[model samples]
Structures are given as structure tokens and as C-alpha cells.
Target: MRKEFLPFARPSIGEEEIAELIDTLKSGWITTGPKVERFTAEFAAYVGGRFAVPVSSATGGLHVALLALGIGPGDEVITTPMTFVATLNTIVHCGAVPVLVDIDRATLNIRAEEIEKKITPRTKAILPVHYVGQPADLDPILEIASRRGVAVLEDAAHAVGSEYRGKRIGCFPTTSVFSFHPNKNMTTGEGGMVVTSDEAVFEKASLLKFHGMDRESWKRFAKAGSPRYDVALPGFKYNMMDIQAALGLHQLRRLEGFLVERERLARRYDEALAGVAGLILPSRVPYPVRHAWHLYTPLVDIDRLTIGRDRFMAELKARNIGTGLHYTAAHEFSYYADRFGWRPEDFPEAHFVSERIVSLPLFPGLTDGDQDDAIEAIRDVLKAFRA
Candidate 1:
């Protein structure tokens, strides 16, 4: 057994990040200010987006984006069941209904063909999640939206560096919200960005991000600015702070290298675990994409084992290996079930994946030796648990 436990994910913070953070602390302007502005601009340039708005979390970004797009009461937003609850919760908070779509078993993304069938007169937008860093098939989804005169918002929480066709995710025509949580490919400590090409959406989201202030509120405290400000509308407190941007400035610069290392680790897992009995490894979509490889989730064939998925995770934990459950089917939750009257059988593929998925260790800091330890531990657990 390995002497130390391996965590499922960890941020790769360097001396530069620490130094930048210290500089921000000593600069005496810790709230949202110059650093946040620089990070937002750099991130926009990096992803080729026309506008970028920084927020406290991806959930916040989603909330603002939906409102900016004029989605509200009686409106319906199409999304996948194989995602975090935040995707559904944000829609509900906007007084909108979330229409669940089934996922492709292999790619674990929302089925594009099935999406068009669910569109109704009340359907306001299509929100597709890029599951585990792979971009969803957007060409068809976007086509459907454009033809139908509805909007498309991408839940790109797990797709910071992911690419669809030849362009990066944020470069697309639709609005994309990215997470900068600690576990994500890049971290701004705890922040997110909403990137879009629509000028109206960008203007509304930027204003709504910081209490609906007329302009950049941080400038009010500067030497050449006025303390007076006006609120055009009531909005939430979702602006990203300068303290968080201190980490983001450095993280954005190193993101490309981080993605390269993560892909290396994922390929290693693929080569080592291929054809391993009782394991269903992740598969790529047929279309061209540069997968960010945020999470290496594989399903355990529990029918061939004595224990269920929870116990399988417990076995790995006992052997000094940590794992993560990326999500449970959104419809399976009590709130959605009671509100929408959904059943586990409604989306069979997502339910199956929800019950079996396990995220193994995949991070820039994970060494090959560490990977070997994880692989060995997994094999040992399967051998012991085999029915």
C-alpha cells in the first residue's frame, strides 16, 4: 500500500500566485478593483470572447446570465440530468422550469437530437453542460436554437480549456459560464467568469454583477473618482474580489501548461485501465475536441461485484485512495422529484452513470508514481470485491 493517501483533486498553486496574493494584500485595495479588471480582460483575450464578467461563483454567473437573457416565470430551460444540482437550482431561482434531457451513454453529454423534441413555445433557452471537460455537441444545439429563435447558455463549469471543433469554448457565439473553484482546472480561489458575444447580455450581466451600480464601483474609492453612485435595478452581491483575482492572474498565465499536464495524466489512466474487467472507462466523442480532462470518471460494473458503488468507494478509501462522485442525477433529488414529478427511470442512462461513476485522481501535481499507486490500489479492490 502507498504510505500517503492520494486526493481526487488539488489545485496547482505556485510561488508566483503566493507573491501576487501578498502584493494585493499590501496594495490596500483588497475588494474588487484593478486586479479583477486585469484578470477579466486577460481571460477574455485568452478565450477569444468579446466580453467577460467576473462573479463569485459559476452559480452566480448562471443566475445573472439567465436574467440578462430575459428568462423568467413560465419559461423553460433545457438541460441535462447528469450534472450538479446548481444547474437546476439557478433556473428554479429565476422562476423558470428546467426540462431534463437524457445523456449519451458513451460521451455522457446531452443528446442533441433529443433536445429539439423537447422544445416548446415556452422554451426560452438550452443550457448544455460540458460533462467532465468534454464540450457537448454544440453545432446542432446552436442550430436548433437559432432556427427556433431561443437562446443558448453553456454550463462550462468543467470546461475551462475545452475546445469544440477548432475554437475554444468561450469563443463560441453563446454565453459560457466558467468556474474557478479550487477543484477546477484553474482556481481564482473561489470565483467564476461569464463570457459572451451578445452586447445586451454582457451589459446586463456586468451591471447585475455588482449591485447594479451604474459603472465600475471600485473606482469610487480611488483618488480621481466620486463616492456617489446610483442603482438602476436591484441586484445580488456576486462580484469577484481583487483578492481572488490575485490568484487568477497567475493561474490564467499557467492554465495552458496545467491543461497539458492534466491530459498527460488522463492518457496514462486510459492506457493503464483499458479493458480492466468491471470498469467502464470514459470515451471521447466522434467529433474533434480538445478535452480539458478535468475529471477522469469511470463507472464500476457493480453487477459483477459483491458490493455497490458506495462500498467500492469505501474500499478505495481504506486503501489510501480518495475518490469523488461528480454528481447524482439531478432529477433524482427530492426537490426536483417533488416539483417536476420525475422518476429514476425517466433518464435511464444518466441514472446508470449517476449510480456508478467515480472520479479518480487527475491533477497537474499527480506524478506517474502516484498514478501507479492509484492503479494498483484499484486493481486490489476489484479483486477483493469480485463476486
Candidate 2:
């Protein structure tokens, strides 16, 4: 067994990120200033989007995006049950009902085919997550959204550099939010960005990210900026600080390299664990896509393993190998279930995946030897549990 506990995920920060952070602190202006602007611009270019609005977090980005789209009490936002609670939480926060659809068994993403059946006249948007960095089947989702005149707001928290059908996930005119949480594909400490090509939505989202000010509230006190500002709408305080953006600016530059290392590690896991008894590895879609490999989650066959997912995690922990539950079915949560009367059977695939999924240690900084240690630990756990 490895002498030290292997964490499920860790941020890879180097001297460059530290230096940039220090530079931001020394610049005297820290909250949502030039570094934030530069990060937004670079992020916009990275995603091939016309505009980017950096925010406090992906959850904040989702809130602003829904508000920008004018989603309110009567609106219903369709999304998946396979994602983090924030995916559904933002819908409720925006005064909209969260309508969840089942996930595709292969990709663990919202089943695009099932979306049409669930769309009522109140359905104002389809909020699909690029689950675990695999792009959701967006072409059909976009087609449905276009025909229905509903918005498509992607919960791309795990998909920074992910692409679908030769096009980047966030490049579309519709709104897409990317997370910069410590455990995400890249780090901005704790930040998020909303990307879009639609000028109107961009403007609305930008305003919503601040205090609903017509112009950024941060600029109002600056010598060159106007002291007067207009509140176009009631909005949340979700703006990203320059301190966070300082890290993001450097992280964005190194994103490609981060992705490369992630892919290599993921392939290594696949090769090492392929056909392992009681394990089901993640699968890729046939479309031309570049998966960002945010989390290497695999499903355990409880019946074959003679123990459930919780026990498996405990066994791994005892062996000093940490694991993570990416999510339990969002709809099956007490709040959602009580409020929406959602049952486990409502979305069978999502419920099943939720029960079995476990995220292994997969980060840009994970060494080959670390991976071997993880595999060995897992094997030991399985064997001990079986015995």
C-alpha cells in the first residue's frame, strides 16, 4: 500500500500562478479589474466565443445566464439528473422549475432524444451538462431548442477544452458556463466564466454578473471610469475578482498542456483497468470530440463485487487511496424529490449510474507511479472485500 493517502483531486499550481497572484496583489487594484478583463478576453478566444463574462463560480454563471434569458417563475429549465446539485440549484434559484431528463448510458449526459418528450410550453431552456468532460449530443439538442425557440444553457463546468463535432462546446451563440474551481480541468482558485456569441445575451449576462449595473460596477470608482451607473435589472453580486483572474490568465495559457496530460493519464487508466472484473469504464461517443478528462469515473458492478459503492469507497480509503462520488442523482435528492415528487425510477439510467460511479485520482500532476499505486490499492481493496 502507498504510505500516504492519495487525494481524489488536487490543483497543479506552479511559480507562474503564484507570481501572477502576487503581481495582482501588488497592483493595488484586485477586485474585478484588468486581470479579470484579460482573463475574460483570453477565455473568449480560447472557446471561440465572441464574449466572456467571468463570475464568482459556475453556479453564479448559471444564475446569471438564466436571468439573462429572462427565465422566471413560469419557466421550466430541462437538465440532467447525473450532474452536481448546482446544475439544478441554479434553476430553482432563478425561480424556475427544474425538469430533469435521463442520461445516456454511454456518456452519462442528458439523453437528447428524450428531451422532446419532456418539453412543455413552459420549457424555456435545455440545460445540458458536458458530463465529466464528454460533450453532450448538442447538435440534436440545439436543433430542438432552435425549433422550439427555447434557450440552450450548457453546464460545462467539467468541460473547459472539450469539443464536439470539430467545434468547441462553448463556441455557439448560446450561453455556456465553465468552472475554474480548484478540482476542475484548470484552476482560478474559485471562479467561472460564461461564454456566448449573442451580443444581447452577453450584455444581459455581463450586467447580471455585477450588481445589475449598466456598466461594470468595479469601473465606476476608477479615475477614467464614470461615477454614474444605471441598474437595468435586479441582479446578483457574482463578479470574478482580479486576484482570481490573475491565476486564471496563466491557467488558460497552460490549458492545452493540462488537457494533454489528463488525456494521457486517462488512457493509462483505461489500459490498466480494461476488462477488470466488476468494473465498467467510461465510453466515448462516435462524434469527433476532444474530451477534457476532468474526472476518471467508473462504475462498479455491486453484484459482481459483492459490495456496494459506499463500501467500495470505504475499502479504498482504508487502503489510503481516496475516491470521490461525482454525484448522487440530483433529482433523487430530498429537496428535489420532495419539491418535484421525483423518484429513483423517474430517471433509471441516472439513478443507476449515481449509485455506482466513483471518481479515481486523475489530475495533470498525477505521475505514472502514482497511478500504479492507485491501481494496486484498488486491487487490494477489491480482494480484501471479496475475501
The best candidate by TM-score is 1
lDDT of 1 by residue, 15-90 (tens): 9999999999999889899999999999999999999999999999999999999999999999999999999999
TM-score (C-alpha, index-matched) for candidate 1: 0.99
Question: lDDT, candidate 2, residue 382?
Answer: 68
Query: How would you encode candidate 2's per-residue C-alpha lDDT over 313-339 as one tens digit per residue?
Result: 988888788899999989889999999
What's the C-alpha lDDT at position 26 in model 1?
A: 98
Scored against the true structure, residue 329 in model 2 reaches a CA lDDT of: 89
Can you give the TM-score per candidate against the true fold? 0.99, 0.98
Checking candidate 2 for backbone clashes, the offending pairs are none
lDDT of each: 0.94, 0.90
